[model samples]
Target: YMHRPAFVALLVVLIIGGTSVGTSAKKAYNYRMRERDVGKSDIVWNNDEYVLLKNGDINKAYKKIEDELGIKALKISVVPLEMKYDRLEIREGIATIKFLFNGQLLCFIQAKNDIASSNNVVSDRKVNSEIYNIWLDKQITIERNKLSDDQIEYSMYLSINGAYYYLYGIMEEKEFEDIVSELRF
Candidate 1:
């Protein structure tokens, strides 16, 4: 009957949608892998697939980094332009990203290596270099009656190599002041 064709078309649409959803989930997995790989470092390249937003101003770059990462920064002082050598293995690694927002002092990142072999490949467990990443579903709840809803929601990320640890949280609070004070840059 005429209805048979419509039913078959509906089935096809469902199949396509399911496949698309699966592909997106796979992409998310790969993205997490990439984030763990290119953690905070001293080399000057952003292989760590980030969503970039630009509005023709350098401050756009500063805002982009802060908004995406949800970290606080403090712009203390600007250094005069000077030529410096980049010895890190990372290709075109950012030597210095000079900007301060929130209260994070000397908030800049650099790459430590230049292993840019797999630019387009989707990350998979089969790939040997995938590092351990934080669980997305799990959140560390801070039990503070004084804190607001926004303050209670935080996640801790352990570095891939376990060199450093990070916690993303809101500013305008005293809890993070101690950590921010220790930053040298």
Candidate 2:
């Protein structure tokens, strides 16, 4: 059921997409600390395909990421007791991974140094104090809106280990706070 033109177009699109993905192919990073600080570290902030991390242990994955990226990678140190958190991964960015919880894709976690405007890739809407609170006495910028009667979208920013992290996706507010509280430097 494919016309000649349609088949050719599909082939062209596949080739283009495959080519782009190839450019960002997975690479292994190693740490060799010198006099360089976090700000001056040479981290490849490039997009990469998902990699299954250290048996899905976040703490183990965090340690591996820190060692590999040659930076102080952030950790969701304690992944809310007994929650199904077997899906964790890391790319070559500000400590990023595709996080899953309770058999659902929770959000994309990204951490980078400094609170630069470039990092505000999330929405500009900010949630009020009633819906958000300062965790660990650290200021958190939040934006949330109900996507439907049962689903709420959340974009939250917080500082940890001298780097800024933002979580963006649809998840329960209570679940979000538990993860925030577990963030350790």
**lDDT for 165 (candidate 1):** 29
- Please identify model 2 stretches exceeding 4 Å from their true place: 1-56, 86-89, 114-118, 128-137, 159-162
Judge candidate 1 at residue 20 and give its lDDT: 100
For residues 1-185, write the lDDT of model 2, one tens digit per residue. Answer: 66998999999999999987775553333323332124744232322222222224555556666776555655564454334444445654555556655555555455555444355464544583333333356656557766646667666776556555666656677767656656554
Tens digits of per-residue lDDT, candidate 1, 43-114, equal 222322432211113334444434543433222122212211122111232223433334332223422223
Question: What lDDT does each candidate get?
Answer: 0.33, 0.55
Per-prediction CA RMSD (Å): 17.9, 17.2
| Most accurate candidate by lDDT | 2
Error of 2 at 163 (Å): 2.8
